[model samples]
Target chain A: MGLDNVTVKPHEKLATALAPELTAVNTLIRERMASKHAPRIPEVTAHLVEAGGKRLRPMLTLAAAKACGYDGPYHIHLAATVEFIHTATLLHDDVVDESAKRRGRPTANLLWDNKSSVLVGDYLFARSFQLMTECNSMQVMHILSGASATIAEGEVLQLTAAQDLATDEAIYLQVVRGKTAALFSAATKVGGVIAGADPKIVQALHDYGDALGVSFQIVDDLLDYEGTGETGKNVGDDFRERKLTLPVIKAVAKADDAERAFWVKTIEKGKQDDGDLEHAIALLKKHDALTETRVEALDWAEKAKAALTSLPDTDIRQMLSEIADYVVARLR
Target chain B: MGLDNVTVKPHEKLATALAPELTAVNTLIRERMASKHAPRIPEVTAHLVEAGGKRLRPMLTLAAAKACGYDGPYHIHLAATVEFIHTATLLHDDVVDESAKRRGRPTANLLWDNKSSVLVGDYLFARSFQLMTECNSMQVMHILSGASATIAEGEVLQLTAAQDLATDEAIYLQVVRGKTAALFSAATKVGGVIAGADPKIVQALHDYGDALGVSFQIVDDLLDYEGTGETGKNVGDDFRERKLTLPVIKAVAKADDAERAFWVKTIEKGKQDDGDLEHAIALLKKHDALTETRVEALDWAEKAKAALTSLPDTDIRQMLSEIADYVVARLR
Candidate 1:
């Protein structure tokens, strides 16, 4: 199936199977967003939450829990917890990146102020903790809390690594895990744990989520370089921010001295303009970094699919495998 | 002995009692701060953690737990959790206030960058959540999470209240509870809960900590107007920032048309200069707002002492009562 079809099929089945749970999570999100003391919090949070981005993180949690035969009510709470954390990170990320847009909408920092974004993000984080506490499971709490710490560490790593061409693959993995995959892995892992799944099943869910998250982020990074008119984000978004993603890191590793000087001047020294993007793309192409990045993304997708072997041969598991395929199929 | 005698005694006894636990917490803090991918994480965190502010929040947890007659290891972990949260909030607060000095040293934002401060603050918050999870106590997690939410809400409330002289007692109370008292209350309450204290004693500790925190913040506000000589903070600091503290609110409430116009011109409109500080102080004196504020602080201190009545008349309880007195006694 195509990527859109794959997403649509699973979402339809999952929504019908977990409609009540999904409703609870939505209610929790609204209730938690309300602030009697700081009206600016809801104002900024609603700007982002209500702006129509897909509830992917929460969906991941719900799907994982359901796939593991979860029959309890706490999954809804965990789903909301995951979404709150993702939203909180997004608010801070926009401020750190100085990005004007997110999900084709004006970011919270852009609509309000960085101050509002930062504080509201913090409010959401606290709210997530509160929600997780309601689950009354220390194992669930540990999983989510550890995920939050990893996400923050990853973001910090990304911030410090930006514009430094010497950043290695290990650092790149840590940054991507923090910036994207940490939440995904945590969301799915917590879902399984809350369901009281067997340790083996929980581990399988975790590995699946981690590989899927890595694949998703790699595709996003690749799209920033090689995606055409179909992808909403423009090419060279990372280049504009002087972000040292996998492609740039790979390209730099393969560059000659003269090309290295050009990158240093344009990216590190912030001397880039419109033509610099074209030159950077040309350099990436010459180094085959784009092709290598695509291969790595596919490799992660296959790894994600392989993890599903440990899961039961349910429709959900099949759909998850297809989802991995869909992520890599985006490159086509 | 009276509360005064307890004030003279250093916290060495409490620290000694809690040493082994505190060491574990310190180890956790250190381990959480480590980021192999980001060398700057430790560098930035060390600048704040090593700056040597009193570990008052953590100590509250330790003291409360010990006072409740519990011998458990989790209290130290919870103590560190509170400290981490407090430290994270301070880093963010400095960035929000654009503050240069904290605890007689340059703020992290000044030494590093606001970006680093912001990210590191986030890192600390995540680490705090992780630390709280280590306690494996849902009650402790709930208390800390609720406090964290309240704290964030209070900050945003303060941000909106800044320069608005019409901010009243009710709003000010919410802000003070969120920004200061919430953490204090949580820190102490978690101690009692972890010690398996009864609900009544837990409530007592919570009330005592809340009252003490309110008194402490109010005294800090009062000192901004009346303090001199090695307190180190500038006098009229609130006036310069146009902060609507208790004194400012009371003074504005009692203002005549002429004084109100002056306030509108100076504080609300941000037209204040060095001379405006003198005029504002003169207005405060004319309305006796300074005296009123001092009286309010004393009232809170009395309330704090009264809250301890439920506790057994032990030395630690007595010392806690005295600590409350010492907080407000600075005004006398």
Candidate 2:
């Protein structure tokens, strides 16, 4: 759904390149998600795992391993571990966001209840840790567990910071760092670690994933104000939800007396009427916040691409660079 | 609070014997629960942690280590890790159960919101993994993560099996095994593992924790039907919640046609009226379920005490045996 317009989608290229490995990752995820005693565990897990989101994170893991000259099977295990963690977070996020739908379908929280989402999310997270431990790499466990903590801390930070009017860019970066980039960096870093790649290569992969994730999230935020597609989310959904996205934060930073009043009323207090969404968009445009946000996203994408300069020259490396470019391309 | 009246409290003996170590665990918990940016993390965690939980699980970890002749610093870390995991699960449990009062005060979910509880719980879980990794033991990691998965799976099984009349004691054991005993056993087993104890001693500690935990939970469930304490749980709370605890499971097993219809109307259909509580208790009494449940608890307690025969005959071991006996002593 993300790269439909590009004739040669970058992620699709990586997916095709690593198709066999990706298949093993998917199979491991399916095999591990099931509970012997609790049918509901598998039932709830299968609902989201089978929903067909592009397996971008796991592919990054595989690509990093193969590019680093790793041929072992543990990369497959690590890839599956990354996907499990991602799925678990999404499940919990649906409940936190009070989401009714995800990927154009009713969320598990809506279909079953919040209890199932919380427990099953927990189950998957625990399963992810178990998968990582099977690799016999304490470093992998250390890295993944640290990322897990960061991710949770980031979500909690967002919960506290999303509504406050005083949230600045540094705090926003921390929030995004915690929420998105932690897992991205961890996914790629563990791939290299598992492959026994050199520390320099592992660090390069980590830097690449960090930049790509930030760029990815920033583009996503920009798209909320820029386009409305059939990806199950509505235009101005973040606006109505009173989220302090990069665009909104930038707009509010430049707000005058009257405009500041509008942000406080709509965002801080959430007293929005029918015309408020249009008015918010107009303000974002007037402050040039949309264009500046897109530029920042492009800058991160460049960093992601540049991280690959020191890595081995391979088809997967080229595709990863292109993947970063394709992310912010939606905003451009 | 649980052992305030008993003259020879087993946990109190362990606490007195291991005061310095327990202090370290408490300090570590305080230091780790704090979030530099999100102050709400500690605020929610402290409300429960400082409410005086007797630190039973962490104490179990500490005692097992001491009994195995572990004179290292990592045991303190493991004890703190176990406590964090336990606290994290409780926070999520309160949210899942929609519980209002805990420890004679408002639950975190009630005070802040479900969002805060869920995210904060996640933070603690990740923090726990971080602490475990600090101990630098992969076997410890494997045991704890596995237990975490089983714990989540058990909660899910209980969620799905709670209202069904077809649930038997075997299923109940699996649920309790997952929900309660997994962590209990892992807590002690990891202590021995960290201490480099012999495998036989480690196995003994694992068996001891398992039976102790099972006995602990059965006593808890039985007490839910017998006592009303300042602890905030009311008698018959499980019945009101339509939970298929051991007593009710046994009662349902022997129900005649008329009784089955009654159970279906009250528990399955949930058309519970005013005398339903009394009637449920009467049915449990008619089946002599309370006495039989207490008997099962004693059997588990005996198994727990008997398992310690192969381990060192130290003061901690003696206290652990008494702990098992004291668990069922409440029912007696």
Candidate 3:
């Protein structure tokens, strides 16, 4: 399914089964975003939260909880908490990347300043912690907190690993898992734990989330290379930033002596230009790295579907599995 | 008492009471700092944690818990949590301030890069949340979360208010409370709450911490002027940075036509040089703003001591109270 088709199906299903809960999550986000003490906090936070994110993290929390047979009100709070954490990271990520644009809009760092981005990000993180405290489940807190640590660690790892030609599959997997998949896994796992699911069910949900997140991120990285003109970002943004994504890492490993020298000069030494992106893409093709990356993503998608075996058969679970398929199907 | 005398007394007391707890906190910090998945995390975090500084926030958590008559081991974990939070903020703060030096050492920003500082700071914050989750106290989580929000808010407020002379006492107090006292109060309050102290004792401890923190910060600002020969930092560091601190705020409020113009030219317009610092100092003295700031610090010190009435007569309580006096006494 395309973006429009996938989005429409979720909207219809969510509106019917999870309407009230979704409303509660939305209200919680707005209310918590309003800081009585610090007015500027909401202003900076609103820029991102109100900025047209898909609310994927929070949606995962809700979907996981519902799929696991949770009927309690706490899921909404957790969903909102997850969103707050995601938004906080976004604000900080823009500053770390020093990127001027996000979601095709001016970044917080550009609109206001880096100072606002940093502080408001901190405020949102605090708010997320406060929200989790209200759930009153140490297990929930533990899962979310662990996810957060992994996410931050992943980001730092990515930072240090950027532009290093010697980056490998093991390190790349860890980075993607940390940077993109940790929260996804945590959001789903927390939902199961909060719903009082069995240990087996919780573990399955965690694996499902982890694999789905990995697949999702791999697809995203692939899109940066294979995306057509209609895609929002350019094909070589990661390359422009000198990032050593899967394609470049694989290509570097397979390069001949002459190609290896070119890779070192263009990537490691940051001597790339627009023409270099074309050459890099050709190199990826010559080495069949793109095909391998897609195969890896498909494998993760299959793993994600397999991980759902412990859950009871339900429309939500089926849709989640389909969603996993939808994430990687775009590559084909 | 002089700095040497005060340092000796507190160092001995802090060592004796907090040695075991401090050791545990340090061990926990080291353990938590490692991200098995992200190799870059340790590289960025160790640049700051191993840079050397007194672990005061963690000690405060341990001290507060001890003073509240608790004999539990969980406080050590909580202490580590607060320290992680504090260190995380410091990392980000250096980036926000564009600072080159902290405690006579090169900042992470200067050593590694701003990217490392921002990302590693984020990692530490996530680690903090993880540590707090281990404590499993809703009230403790609530207090720390609130403090985190306030700290971030204060930072943003400071950013927005910097170089603007119109900032008032109320706004300034809010900023100071957020930037400094919020963490202090939360750290102390969480300690008491975790110890299962009475509500009254918790409130007393919280108030004591807030006032003491305010006094401590004021003394720090004063030392920017008073420590011309003793302290290594240059005099008028805040003035040069155009930070509208208490002394500068008061002086600006009391300025005549010529004085106001000079301030506008130097601070507001960023036209300062070597002679400007001397003139700014002379103006501060001319209006007795230093004395005024000193008196305010003493008032807070008195309030901090008075807040201890709810605590029983114990050596720790007395030392905490005296520590308040000793902070302000540095001005004399």
Best by lDDT: 2
Candidate 2 lDDT tens digits, A1-332: 23353667777888998989988998899999988999999999999999888888999899999989999889988999999999999999999999887887889999999999999999999999899888989899889999998998898888888779898889888888889999999999998898898999999999999999999888888888987675456688788778899999999999999999999999999999999999999999999999999889989989998998889999888888888878876664
The residue-by-residue lDDT of candidate 1 on A1-332, one tens digit each, is 54445445554555666678888888989998999879999888888888776677787898898889988888888999998999998898888888888877778888877877888889999999999999899888878888887887888888778888888778898888887888888888998899888999899888888998999899999899888846666677789888889988999999899999988987788789768898998999999999999999989988988988988788778767777777777776
Consecutive 10-residue window with the lowest summed lDDT within model 1 chain A: A2-11
Best by DockQ: 2
Candidate 1 chain B minimal-lDDT segment of 10 residues: B1-10
TM-score of 3: 0.95
- Across B163-223, the per-residue lDDT of candidate 2 in tens digits comes to 8888899999999999999999999999899989999999999999999999989988988
Using TM-score as the measure, the top candidate is 2
Candidate 3: tens digits of C-alpha lDDT, residues A1-332: 33334544553454456678878998999999897767788898888888877777788789899999998999999999999989988888888878888877889999998888888998889899999889999999989988888888889889878878878988899899998899989999999999999999999989998998999888878888888835455677788888888888889999999999888888789898668888989999999999999999989988998999889999888777777777776664
List the candidate 1 regions with Cα displacement exceeding 4 Å: A1-20, A227-234, B1-28
Q: What TM-score describes the B chain of model 1?
A: 0.94
Candidate 3, residue B282: Cα displacement in angstroms equals 1.6
Interface RMSD of each: 1.0, 0.8, 1.2
Classify candidate 3 by CAPRI docking class. medium
In candidate 2 the C-alpha lDDT for residue A46 amounts to 93
In order of listing, the candidates' clash counts read 0, 0, 0
DockQ score of candidate 1?
0.73
Candidates in descending TM-score order: 2, 3, 1
Model 1, range B67-88, lDDT digits (tens) per residue? 8987878887888788889989
Q: Candidate 3's residue-wise lDDT over B249-332, tens digit each?
A: 989999999999998998789898768888888988999999999888988989988998889888888777667767776665
